[model samples]
Target: MKNVIEDVTCAGCCCVCDHIQVTTDGQQIIDVQTTCPQGQAWFAQSRQTEKQQPLIKGIDASREAAIARAAGLIQEAQSPLLCGMGQSAVDAQRAAISLADLTGATIDSGASAATRALQQVGEANCTLGEVRSRADLIIYWNAENLRFNAHHQQSLVPPGEPVPRKIVTVGSELPGDSRGVDLSLTVSVEDEFEILWRLRALLKGVALEGTTAGELASLAALMQQSSYIVIFFGPASPDERLFHRKLEALSLLAREIQAERRCHTINVPAAGATKGAEPVLAWQTGYAAAVNFAAGYPRFSPCEYSTVKMLEQGEADLCLLIGEDPLTGLSDQAIQRLQQIPLIHVGPVPLVDLQPEVYIPTGISGIHAAGSLYRFDGTPLPLRALISTQQASEAEILNQIETLLKPVMHIC
Candidate 1:
């Protein structure tokens, strides 16, 4: 018998698209109805046979044994780092934070760069619904097409909307489809900060001495005429410093626009659970990301508490990676350093190249397990499982590890 599930959340990307309709047949997701390609891929990959087993030292092991081995690694290490909360559910992230506190480990998300950048530039944003229903002028600033594709564009304007929304793209590369974008301004990524600053100045009618003033003025005129403006920024650039500057400029521009009219900035993060992880970390530890719980409390240190920095400095002897694969996001240098340490991974193994000492297989959120996830706009959505799995959820695995570590923690 086939069953249909509606309003199923997709934990595929930061978008957290929750309106997916899943068709399942007795513990298997037969089909997924969603506009996002990533969401489709997430549901398709959930049923792969390779992702259904727990492994200890690359050998198949029981869940209990794998959890025990993972706990042993954490217990033996002087400094253990917990990373990769971006792919797990919010409940899993909360459990990971608790485990970090219990073990005095450092916690960081895969989207730490974007999180740090957001911290540098305070948020002046609104929900996707607000942008769709009200925004007249939409700006894609340094937006990546793969992450923010045509589906996103459709979502913003939607179908049957009579309001003629003017879409603009300001980035190094012009998006593939010019039909979706009303205006395309191609500027090098390095010059994004300057362009944004000049545009903001032009909007405020304080422009003087610039060859690009005419272009800036043209863009400013659109912003001035629009009732609601929404700027979508994708900050997944290779250059970290440049990304920060872009974010700062975007924030400043949003503030300037808000001074005159309604303006909202949307940060399109590259990780799946980044939107969810930030709030869980903030509510539990009083900080957003890159936190250390070694002092018996949360310590905010964006630079020092970062997973890459911790690995680079050799401060953390053991690493606990949750949900996502560590090799996927880590830099080459960070991966090399991680390979030297004792690593415990609690999720589906995306690749076996950088195999951890212990791998405890876990179900994917919103696919094989049901939980809550946060949308890009920080809105909580229900994640319904489309299939059942023998593998434990990331939260359950972390909690079990916590249970095992509590007695050892008390003895110390």
Candidate 2:
């Protein structure tokens, strides 16, 4: 017999979409509805039979033995790094942080590109609900085809809405579809800062004297006319240092716009557990990302405490990565460095090429396990399990590992 489940939260991306429907045949998920392609894939993959078992040095081992071995690695290492918390549950993130604290390890989300940008130049943002219901003038700045999902586009100018929200894109290339954007300004990536500065000046009734005056004037007119404006930008760039400067300019522009209008700037981050990890780390450690507790307390340093930086510097000899694929966002250099260390991965999927010393398979949060996930705007949403799985949740595995490490710590 098949049962229909409504309002199932999806763990696919940072959106943490909660209005999903799943059709289950008691033991397996048969269908997923009311979700995007990404969410659908996440649900489907959850039911697949290719689950991983715990391993010790490439050999199959029981859960207890695997946990013991993982604990031993942490106990023996001079310096350990715990990272990849962005794709796990909040409870799991807490456990990982606690474990790091206990073992004097450096902790990072590994998905710190966007977070680093945000930290450099603080954001003035709002909830997705605010963007959907209140925003009338939406600007997709430098985020033509990079960020935004199907749900995000739909919510920008929702169907049957009384007031029509105008969409504008400012970048080197306009986004592919015309349906999502009403206006497209072909602005060079190098000149993005100049364009934003001109807009801010125009808003202040400054005379336009340059070649880009006409374009900036037009954008300024739209902003002045709209009651509410929301600007979205993704800080994914080739040059990391340049990206931070652009983000600072963008943030300043948003603040300047707010002096006259209701403007909110949203930093569209790369999806996964990043949204979940940010708030948890901030509340617990007083910093958002790339933190080290090795000094007996939390110390924030994006450059120094970054997972990739720590690995490359050989500051950490062992890694306890939780609930994220290491290869997905890591740079080639970082990947190469990780290959030389002892890694213990706790997640559903295994790394293909560079195998970890310890691999403990776990359930995907919000699909096979119930937990809390934060949305892009930092709103916490409850996730429901659609089906049962023998594999443990990331939180469960981390907690078990933490428990096992306690005795070893006493002995050492």
Candidate 3:
């Protein structure tokens, strides 16, 4: 018998490393490569054969019992919130969307706000192709840290010929990892806006504000000389409005440069894809609003419908956590709310503390389940399942829930 080693890729993590090679003795992955720590840990977690004991409100129950209880909670709750889907198969995402439609439920994804912010900059942005093809001046505003969420993605941005692209970094720290950047202008986060204002004044030849940091003068000189420029931006932190003001100033600078000197300028987000692209494209449309409404009609408002805020305010009684883990970066209060809720956990991670109403063990997305994912450049990559798990597949579990919902469809 020929031994067939399973090959899997990962899209759950940010690096989007698709070159994972897996060696399987039979149904188990004996080895894996070309993946990061998170990817490695994720695949290893899938090999365990321990039959997960289904639970409800901290009590162990059979799989059937757990599913029934989960379905019952959906039927009883006035509003059901479906959160996280960045790690699910396309089929499962569609199923989740269908489930939300059938029952007046709210479905939201991670990174929705940041995605929307980029959308507003559409036609005012650059694709990876454009940056590599023509850009000369690359300005990274608060995007100095390029931590690859997966593995080494450094190879993606190769050094250009004649000279590598000039990099003007405007942030607290300069990244030592990204190899090809030529110039770096490090600045304190507190004075970022002040620096932008100085740049605007210099561009218009109207200097005032008692001059700037010496490095700022050097950056202004570089910007004046460049023919084409790309400004990369990270998502706004807690003081969102302040961060946005700096970006707005940058955009204005781009416009002024283009009109005055025929220079081309574009803004791009730190992570994957440019703007008005795939996942981001889906977001700019009615997708976000359609997904967030629990009343069967679409509603749009980051403030009113944000799942993180909702959880913090104790608004949601039951939460169906899908793709990502909220415990990683959410506030302590929000995490506490997650603990308080009757969660229907349906992903790879096993909830050790809070027993989910319906616990599901699933395969690692992109690796164990084949699907389409977007690259940082809006390129669509097709994935193939590396290995299969004994636990129910995401589609199967969703089907089971839909099957159970048939009897209670008319209740709401």
Candidate 4:
């Protein structure tokens, strides 16, 4: 019998488009509707693909047997690095954190720069619903971030908004559709930081020397005139060179404007399974990522404990890689370093040009397993299991791994 599920959530990107509809034949997904191309690939390809088995150093092995070897590696290593939670469920992320805490490993996700900036000044954040319903002024900071979510433009900046929405784009690189922009302030990445700094000065009625854009003043005027404003920003450039500094500047500027009138700064998520990652990490370790638990207490250090730093230095003897995402998180240098270390990978997606000491292929949460994911707006959403599969879910595999190490680690 064919089964139809309504209100299914898409796990493609951080947008967490929850209005998707799926049609299944009890064992495999037949159709998916009301979602974008990313969702289509996420739902359909997950089920249509071939299954993978557990491996121990290029040889296939039972999960139970592989767990023992993996536990031995954990036991033998002096310094261990636990990384990647991009594609894992919320429960899985918590489990990974627990494992890291028990094993005294340095845990990090590849994408923690924004989290680092937010930790410094804190985010002026709000829901996507609020942006769509109320915001009179919507500014896309980098605009390139919009490519991650196909529905954002239509969902947040739809036409026929009760009042005409004044659209503004900052930075030289804009998204594909530049039709309705009220003002497009084209500035180089180097000058972008100064633009936001000047805006903050204008907001405070403080004058700064050596002005760049007359358009900066006009953008400030729009902010003061508008009833509510929302700034949507993403990675500054492909390399994300000065991303952290730029983000800190943006946060400070938004805080200044928010003092008088309503303002929110929302981050457009990168294309990754890392939604709700920061929230979960913060709840568990009191820090988002780049956390070191080797002292048996969570230590927050962006420079010292980040995965890139650890990998680049080849400081870790054993690496526990959990889950995968399309883009964002691990960089080329980090991946090269990870290759040098003994790795135990547990998740649905496979790594390219890399094999692990232990590989346990698990189910995708929204595809073959039931779990919870988050939207970019920090909204919680449920992921429904759409089809039957042979493999275990990510949460279960993580728990199993944690169980094996607990006895050896001797944590009460």
- The best-first sequence of candidates by lDDT reads 4, 1, 2, 3
lDDT of 1: 0.78
Q: RMSD per prediction, one decimal?
A: 2.3, 2.4, 4.4, 2.4
Q: How do these models rank on TM-score, best leading?
A: 4, 1, 2, 3
TM-score of 4: 0.93
Over 118-152, each residue of candidate 2 has an lDDT whose tens digit, in order, gives: 77767888988888778899898876543356766
Model 3, position 181: C-alpha lDDT score: 53
Taking the tens digit of each residue's C-alpha lDDT, what string does model 4 give over 319-376?
8888864225556887787778898888787666788898888888888888898777
- Please identify which of the two predictions, 2 or 4, would achieve the higher lDDT against the true structure: 4
**Which residue pairs collide, candidate 1?**
none
Question: Positional deviation of 402 in candidate 3, in angstroms?
Answer: 3.3
Give the clashing residue pairs of candidate 3, or none: 273-376
TM-score for all models, in order of appearance? 0.93, 0.92, 0.79, 0.93
lDDT of each: 0.78, 0.77, 0.60, 0.78
What's model 1's TM-score? 0.93
Distance from true location, Cα of 207 in model 4, Å: 6.0
Writing each residue's lDDT as its tens digit, candidate 1 over 1-412 gives: 9999888877787776667789999778888898667778888877673456777878888888989999999999989999887767888999999999999999987556656667777878888888878889988777655335555655666556567678788878875867766677888876777888888777778855766666667788888889899888875565354465667777888887787789988877654334647778878887777899899888988778877788878888999888765545566678788889998888765446778888887788888778898777777888876777887789999999999999999899
Candidate 1 wrongly placed segments (more than 4 Å): 49-51, 117-121, 146-148, 158-161, 208-211, 271-276
